[model samples]
Target chain A: MSATQSRPEPKQDEVYSALASARRPKPPGRLSMCLTFGWRGMLKIKHVPEQLIDVTLTPVLFLLMFTYLFGGALAGSTSEYLQYLLPGMLVQSVLFTSVYSGVALNADSTKGVIDRFRSMPVWRPAPLAGAVLGDSVRYLVAAVVVVVLGLIMGFDPGSVTGVVAAIALIVVFSFALSWIFTTVGLLLRAPQAVMNAGFMGLFPLIFLSNIFVDPATLPGWLEAFVHVNPVSHLTTATRGLMGDGASAWEIGRVLLEAAALAAIFAPLTVRLYRKAS
Target chain B: MSAQLAIEAVGLVKTFGATRAVDGVDLAVPRGAVYGVLGPNGAGKTTTIRMLATLLRPDAGSAKVLGRDVVAQADEVRSLVSLTGQLASVDEDLTGRENLVLLARLLGFTRADAKARADELLEAFGLADAAGRQVKNFSGGMRRRLDIAASIVVTPELMFLDEPTTGLDPRSRNQVWDIVRALVAQGTTVLLCTQYLDEADQLAERIAVIDRGRVIAEGTPAQLKASVGQGALHVRLLDADRRDEAEQLLARALDAQVHLEPDPARLTVPVTDAGRATGAIAELSAAGIELADFALGQPSLDEVFLALTGHPAEETVDEEEAA
Candidate 1:
């Protein structure tokens, strides 16, 4: 007890030595910071493995349920439905899972991690960019699941080139779509709000388009809206690439929509994220 | 550039919607001195610290940290200064070790150097055992220690600690105080914000008493206590009805401001000399006021706050700040 009575006096001479050991040699470049933030985003998913359930289980279940449940009703056979619905499912799965990027960012912002990153001397946009980069894995996971499940269910792309190009296009589109979610996450105050907003905004885009059915079957006015829908264009582009019916014009249109989305949301997300506490 | 001052500001202001959280504040903190900003929760101490740390831009005025403007040269200021916000800002998903290493790496350390620095900090902070545990699992005190350690991944010349020991037990509080002492011993300029008067008294070489977003008083603790005069005299009346009579007697005899309402039937007045106590007692007896208790004591920080602001520190916190 006597030994604990007296507090230790702090020594003064070693301060410089201690600081030298902890010195920052140089500030990381913007690209390195982006990668670092991306790595952090992935680490969060690793720690909370439940976060990946959306990207993993949802894709498999959707492929099985939609291919079997709607195949006969719409396309006249399960095999025929697989060809039409698999491409749609791929787009839907990636689009849905990409929204989690916003939810996760919202959750992270509520905590102190974002503040720590902002306080650093590194590039300011690195954390936001890294988050999108890290969550891109979810998009990758969704894309793989849909393709593998579709191929196993007796679906054919008609050409390996078409399958590769379509998968590549889907991945790019998901990455672009994630920027929109990132913007929503930045604007919202709570993760639950981001999740709700994401689902509400994405549902209309996915269901109202030709992702699940032909637009011609709708009323004339409804058909017009569906044809102009961005998601509808993306689904059409995917169907063409995977079935040999895709026109260069259709794929080009999808790319332009992705570019437009990135152009608008990327700057907004970065601006909002910089202003985040 | 004034190399002797760690911080210099002129009329810094920040408003939240209709509430002027911080308004027209000025500060000059000399290098190598521990300056404390003492206030109640919503007194705008945290907002002022955030502005100086470059976390929030001020609505008016300007501030410089380590000679760099907080807004225009925020990047340079960030490199030279660090902040441990009122909220511990460490990553919860990462392990204590991983959190430190990640910040070290982000600060431009090589992988091996980052690991080495993380290990050293974990060992120094007595977090070696919990190094492998996720930060989310750490106790409040452990998390606070890690949060502060992360800020020093580079030994910043100036550090801002906003309520560093707010929720800690006495033992943990002492540990944080020791850390602050060590940092100052090594020439780091510290600006600590706290509601705990004793904490500021113990660690700060100078203090500013802030209320309603303005610095109402600024001085060393001894000077602030001295400004209230020699000491305070407490006189309790046996009959509640005679409280006013006793208060009048004391105020007339001592020729000083008298304070009432702190107790149901008590009279508190400032006295410039211990000799005034005798005069006060005689005056009360001459006025036929019986006393239940009588004591004379030196001023505490609480009394200092009361004398300066007409309200105690704990009760003066703005409602918005409390939320």
Candidate 2:
């Protein structure tokens, strides 16, 4: 051996500086962060099964209420209208369920759960990313259960495969939406105020979308507003995927719109979450 | 021979708006010695420990734990040190064994190693029987034991305990003391922050008495006690209105100077131990000084704390002060 010695090779962990990395580590093939967080959230659900009372009943109730109350004026036949409204109701229920992201974060803080985690040596982002990953499961299951129930009640859209695609699309969009509120939850000091903001700001976003009526059927200005709405794109995408005849362009626009929503809100929520207490 | 320094902090400062939680301060702890930060609540002891533990950033100065810079090498420092904060709790949903096992996993132990560590800690902390019981059912002392055990799952080289016995009952406090001694025996350097002087006296190799974010006095317990002893006796008068009569009489009788309150019944004369105490009492009685109760004393840490704060030794701890 030579008298002079060179530096030793760096370990796998030294591959990248965490500070320099733009995104958090998703280490290849260990435990996908998605599963770890997903498991934790699922455990909480098993303990408090009562949380399901809303997701199971809300969509069915809303579909019936609208089909019976406003279906005559809107669509003439209640059956034809549900095929249209059920797709939108699926989107609404998934979106509404996403608000729990903030509620869960707030509860953890109030209960000193987050403080306990802070003292522990786990990855700072793991608990957060895990919560999001876990909630995806809840949203996906809710979307599927609601649609399966709708299918049994003669709310047929098209092929089984096509209906599956629509549910999958709604699940992806809802996961993206929940991250936005998770950040909102992180920034808002109190869960009560955050829930109030949801009731106020979120209520309008849901109603203003094309969930209740077709954009062309509305007043000219309102139709223009509805046509440009991102939620409209999601609703349109879901309706197309579930319907018998929908073009590639219609599906493409839905995906493109969904991507744009993710682009705008994903980074905004990350920034808000970092600044959260 | 140079002893390894477990912790070194200098000019560390942190300000929350206008209030300086930890003002400019310096700390040095030798490896394998128990160092105590003795102070009342809000004297910046907890903030100082937080900065050292790498949980809170300091606005100024720097710290090194096991030669790792706290800010620059925080992860490395964290790996070497474990902190049991006052607010920590065992996971209420998880069994006590699971809590320790989970901590072991986070510290990079394998399943077998984690379980072994969990079992060892459970027995050490007297939680063997309650190991499988959910932490929610455990009493306050059992939870505290589990929390401390969890912090040391990796057998950290340096440990920080912040007021670990603040609200504990006497027996429970002794149980905590046993665990703390066991860690020190294993050569873990411990820096304990406590407002209770008795804890410092019992556990620390050296103590620093802090007040209003500054070190007012620091040394071994015996050294500090010696500094404030002036060979004196203190007598409390029974009647609040006892005026100058006692002081005048004792001064004339003792031939040594005597001082008393502006009251009539009390007088303090020079003294050392109980032998000198007997002589002073005999002199007081001979002089016809009507004393109610008299006790010979050297200043305790209580008096030392009162001296630094410029307030009476016995005053209600105002709620706002703790906040």
Candidate 3:
């Protein structure tokens, strides 16, 4: 619009092209712009597996290393530690993996790929949407792979419905979270900045909660914050279903918290998403 | 499809802080003509195109494209035009066919329509055999052809090509020339921005030569050449400094109104007569002046550019973009 003419005399399309005028595409007929973008992501993944490696290996290693060394000090036994650590690892893996959305997006924007897309008549949200969907697969895959490996390593799953339901919730949260990080990526040009900011956030959130330790061990105020913490809800629900002696109300509470966060985070993230591009 | 005004840019000024990139240039490009904007780097050719492409904001200006106000009617303007930039802007990961089809689908074509259009473009651009090859591996020419092909899939009546053949080989450049000719044959209007004078000569119907952010000279290619000087001449100097001295002697020895480019190593003069160059060489040598290389031909856009801009097109767009 900086150059779209504002003259009183209206010009038709052909006249505009001759004059070397620039016009954007509107409601173009292609239904697969998002898929095309997704395909591009898949193509990029072929050239580099490092992106998925962090998602794939980071959670498994974090759980194994944290549980083996600190399990005694935190939970008094390795087995009890495994039960507590696995569920929170699920949420953490998804949240952490989503930060790549910001990194990859920033790289693409700086390279002028975003500018190229903006000039096209493709769907406005296709690039962001496709990338989110494509990358969410890694989060889902990582969570599942880590859990299956954890089970083989002697972590127990008590109820089939509970395990599947827990996994499904984490997937949705990760996708929602991707919307958030992607917005940040669009706003920032540097990927390293996004990674550092995401990591600095991750350390405290994981450290302050009952991800490994019993919540009863925390001080009163800190414990109160943990009681309502989103990670706590998911951990309690997963622990309860794993036969750690939680009540049905614990399951209800987790579902309610997850629903509330989804409701709160989704719309805010979407408005940010629109503005980022 | 026949709009009264194809483009209207009034008081279009785009500045970046202390630098006024496009310092209030006005332009009107009507339907079905190739309007070429020629300039050296930092002269705001690309910046002006960016404003027209709606990729940047104007500090103070208003434009309308195909009857839509740039800011107020951006989406409407977006619906009708296409731009092919200096570098090939196609996705490198996709195959030529996939790139075209994906763009077609995004542009609202049905699956069948998209495939059909993609196939047509592939054949048209001589990429049918390479349609399945990933674009990242493509030659410069192939990628440029694909870029233009992807943009024109919708048969946009308005196209903005900013230095479309900047780094292409001669064969690839000619391929684009054919494509531009084909588009014009179909009544599509093109606004071409290029540093290549010969390209403007071959493709543009009217030329707008910009220098230091203003239209210093404009007209048909022939008219611009006439504005600077008429025919061409060569000066032979035996030594380098004498080359400089010979330039001064020739400026006065032939036509008194002639202007000599500062560097006589590659000098151009207006007078066409062959004997005047020979006579000047004899007089300069007798007067103890020496020379190196000299030749005579028709007046070139290079001379016209130097004469009008007071500087050679020393600034390349690529180096400016790096900044």
Candidate 4:
């Protein structure tokens, strides 16, 4: 039997008649196009639920593994260490999840969809900007999972405002960090390269920082290096805000770092995105 | 600067490192006409289309779509034109209807308007039933139809279809051809780039035979065929033994190179006109060589390309691929 034999043939007149009656209005403005692409990013996640695993499972596994596995050794008990480790894990998980934005963007560029988007008369940077913005949801998810799970694990943030401020900091930082990956995605030829490059570069920054252990306990030279690590600064700021009240100076420095990254890599990603074929 | 011209390009050039993907090429396509760029694979058809569609910046020269410079006023040109690439460029992760709706909304339709426009296009392209199915699950032909539909969400003044039917079967190819005809009938100017000569002959009002990143021959299909030599005359000898004699006799009689075929003992000679076919037939019969078949045939596109480029399109594709 013929494949899909029951499929009916569309009548020629019906097709022509429908096309003739189509009324095309003026194209949407820049913001509308940006929002449309942002929605597409979420739609893609909905279609492929596996993409949610990083934000969902990573928080659970990393929080549980690090808390129970190294909690008693690092501190006196799992519950005591959970307070410090949870905030750091939030920063770590959010950082790890941010790379997927670049991987997704790179994957999208290789598909036929980017060619169609380029041909459209919409805003030139909408797809890139929307992708970066839409990926904020992942950071939000990771942040929420960490906070809710940390509370259940007996890790208290002490105040709602403090938790909100810490999550806000992580999201802003993740948004800026996504630009770095976005630029990489735009420049790289393969999606796999974006992931590999992201992990290889980010792992050193994450592991060598003050996330897992205190920088004060390390040797003088190593402590000095860890003190200067951007991840260390971010994790420290996050812990301060999430635990007690953070100093304005400490919060301002992380914000400055995030703003600097956005300032440099946002324009760079846009330029490279424009040049991508 | 003619008002009737939809697209005008002068000395357009694009180079990729060491390779000049799109060499100095010029084209003048009149409004409401199908202009076909016929070439083999890697002959720069896609590259030229990309430049005209404002997807790639030309290294030299300039092009104007609807009087808007492709470089200086690319946004204006983009607003007035749409392009369906060789690959079906619709998003694969989204459903067919979702893809159309997304493009429609981006093209500025309101939520209701976008949904209505999408429904119309889905039904129009015979994709209404498959609207809910993800594009990755659809067949190639369906995806191609959806891609074309996506491009026309705004009903652009000028449209570029780059090899719209490259890998389609005959029926699906016909469907695409019908769509092109329907678009042209609706007052849209179409610039179609394809390797299939028959596709150009059947659809394009004018054909440009491009090879090695340059237009070697430009004319109507019939005009290009006539440029090679007029028509061809094929004669089949009844006796296999007299194949050589028949070839020699016809070559001398017609003053043309006669190609011999042993399968049917056939000899084909290029003739200037239908009048020359009579002379070849008379001479073949006079030599006591009974003819099984004799007919005057118009030159096919393969012959036209062979005559103009010194190699047929199929052979050129193979040679370039091998290289």
Clashing pairs in 2: A37-A130, A38-A134, B231-B271, B242-B263, B242-B264, B243-B263, B243-B264
Q: Candidate 2 has what TM-score?
A: 0.80
Error of 1 at B122 (Å): 0.7
Instruction: Residues B134-211, candidate 2: write the lDDT tens digits.
Output: 677776677777787776666668888988887666767787876777677777789999877678889999988877
In terms of lDDT, the best-performing candidate is 4
**Candidate 1 residue pairs in clash (backbone atoms < 3 Å):** A240-A246
Computed on C-alphas against the true complex, the DockQ of each candidate is 0.39, 0.09, 0.20, 0.49
lDDT of candidate 4 over B1-323, digit per residue (tens): 55668999998999999999888999999899799998888789999999999889999999989998999999898888989987778888889989988988888789998898888888888888889988888876788888888877777789999889876767878888988888888888999998777799899999888877888889887787678887688777789889888888888878989887657687788888787679778887888999888888767656777788777676655554354
How many clashing residue pairs are found in candidate 2?
A: 7
Q: Write the per-residue lDDT of candidate 3 for residues B99-156, one digit (tens) a residue.
A: 8877776776667877877876676566777788778777777778788877787777
What iRMS does model 3 reach?
11.8
TM-score of 4: 0.91
What lDDT does candidate 3 reach at residue B221?
A: 81
Error of 3 at A69 (Å): 3.2
Model 4 stretches with alpha carbons more than 4 Å out: A1-4, A8-10, B229-243, B249-255, B260-302, B312-323
Ten-residue region with minimum lDDT total, candidate 2 chain A: A14-23
Put the candidates in DockQ order, highest first. Answer: 4, 1, 3, 2
What is the Å distance of residue B44 in model 1 from its true position? Answer: 1.6
Name the candidate that leads on TM-score.
4
